[model samples]
Target: MSTLTDLRRSMVAEARRRQRLTWLISAVVLVALPWIFSSSFSISIMTQIGIAIIFALSYNMLLGQGGMLSFGHAAYFGLGGFLAMHAMNYIADGAIPLPVPLLPLIGGVIGLFFGFIIGTFSTRRAGTVFAMISLGVAELIAALSLIFVGFFGGEEGVSSNRTKGPDFFGFNFGPDIQVYYVAAFWALIAAIAMFLFSRTPAGRMANAVRDNAERAEFIGYSQRNVRMISFCLSGFFAGLAGGMFAIAYEIVTEETLNMNQSGAVLLMAYIGGVGYFIGPIIGAIIMTLLRTVLSNFTELWMLYVGLLFIATVMFVPSGLTGLLMMHGPAWKRRSLKRLLAPYAAISIPSLAVIMGVGGLLELTHFAHTTSMDDRVMTLFSIPMNIDSLLPWAGLIALFIGGVLGVRRLRPMLLDAWADANGAGGGD
Candidate 1:
């Protein structure tokens, strides 16, 4: 009995050590990131990424941990932004003397209030019924935004001056870099708080209810209460994120509360891997990069985003993080090195396939959309006439070759994977 207790204590101590190490590393990285990329544009992008990380994490609290698939999560986010904007305006008008940095608390409180009200009824049922109710609530709120011109500002939405709030420690936050630091601080705090929440008994019961509500109820736990608590907490974090958005942009528009925003957050959470705590953070970063960087390069960025999401769903249902986690067993066994060559062999053909498909998509889009005088289009820096057949033929050949090569090398990859996982002869 003493040995067992000692072993458990050792394991708990080890976990705490790892947790501390992780936070220290995260802090170093966050502090160094802005310096590494000091450009104004880069800082702006980083600010957006920070906001996205908070939003995605909040969404995961519900969908990933509580088994709640909320279709209108953005409602809380947008509402928070709107109310935060109003608060900022009031500060500007001298009606309120609050500091700008602390205004997100108002958003959090409002989100909690609405979340409690919504969750009271929504938590009565789970799964599809809850999802439908959320959708209806989101739609109703969206429609009201258009109708209530005083607060929502009609189609134009509401705007504010974040700099008007009382200065914090002699900083008015007049620059983007200053705002980035503030966002970074909040994001780190929110993340740490959510992580701690996940360790609490309420969080554990939420998970229990998520996995098996009936069993949780049998154990005398109210599944509805567990869900309501999770829902409200998720909303609070989301509202906090929305408040950050208002401070960063100084505007809260109808687009902020729309279905598109909700869908985007959902995609980020799912693509990042809802099963893991760090998954949404990765998803938020990747998606923000895609939205900002990729959109600058291509008009068909949304199409690419859709394709990536579909592929993730079909091939990597557990998400990118899940795919990464799958290699852990092999790494622990020191067998991962065996699959390196096979992965490299498959990667070349896969790259070719992706390039070929992108070429075809661009060419097809150009051919249908470009004027006769604008027939020339560039693929991989090579100018090709959209009206010509040569580019079409070349792209088709490349795609076919890539397809055949992938098929031929697939067995090698399979054999390598099996070997690494201790299911095959090769070692």
Candidate 2:
């Protein structure tokens, strides 16, 4: 009958005893999660989310936890994916005699090998210089992706048939669902392992160096060593994510290790709230869902993503998870209900405006085969599907009204924030 508070107290009282149980529970959950999914689609989504979470978390180790910002994280991730694809090929070709389940380890070893080499130079210069070096390194490799046809498969990249795996207990992984099981199992394992890593001595030192390298140096902790170690570990996990990605997608390309992939990692980690351990996980899941679902609905999705990213930096600098964390105090105080009305009032119109604008922008650039010539210039999200004047008038009215309402509400929202922070009374 112990609650979360009770569990926290017990952990504080006997850390080891509770930590062991936590890990054991995690193991069970990872094993059972795939079984809980109703369909292959759900499992596939979960697999991607889990891999992305691992990738985001590993990236955060360098950026958020170690304060060593990297721009070419995909170097490790893509390197790992390419290696795994090659490994899968080798397995298929009978060049190597390893089981498919252990193919990811090959990717990890390859990533760690390069991570050490890259970290040796990059870790020495942590900030902007390091970022540039990483970017250069990534571009170099990405160019190689097009040149090295012998190894990289030149533009086409590489593909590995997972069906090449030997049957285990009659499970040949012949179906996508079976592949999901494999991916899900590893995804969960990677997540739990990465989380465990965050609690270790190295992880704590990484945090210390992140906060104050000078202070860490004074405490006899070598900042360079700490940074290098973090870089290597982060690379290993990113590689693991790449391996999962390769297996899930069954293809590895130069694009996999390109600057865009690297940027995606940065976006996922920061947008998820890199300040917290669990932030990247939330970010990855939400970002993956958005990438999957939203891309289907719009061609100009990247524009909105850019807008969202800018808004996050400008207003909600803490990211989505941070916003969710903001709700904790109200929940703790049992006073969330009192603020519900205003929150809904502000959110509804705000969301509407966003969606309306988003829809219009997306439709203008849509790449779908069916294009209608009957121009229905819908304004402000009021379905002007049929070429009509009403839509135009409605759009203008909505924009003016929305802008005015938001301007007036801005002061109220600010006051609410101040009141919540105990700066002033609501009256």
In order of listing, the candidates' clash counts read 0, 0
Per-residue lDDT of model 1, residues 390-425, tens digit only:
998998888888999999999999988888988844
Regions more than 4 Å wrong, model 1: 424-427
Q: What does candidate 1 score on TM?
A: 0.97
What is every candidate's alpha-carbon RMSD to the true fold?
1.6, 4.4
Instruction: Report how far off residue 12 is in candidate 2 (Å).
Output: 3.0
Q: Model 2 over residues 113-203: C-alpha lDDT tens digits?
A: 8899988988875779888988898899888888989888888889988767655577656676666666667766776777677778888
Extract clashing residue pairs from model 1: none
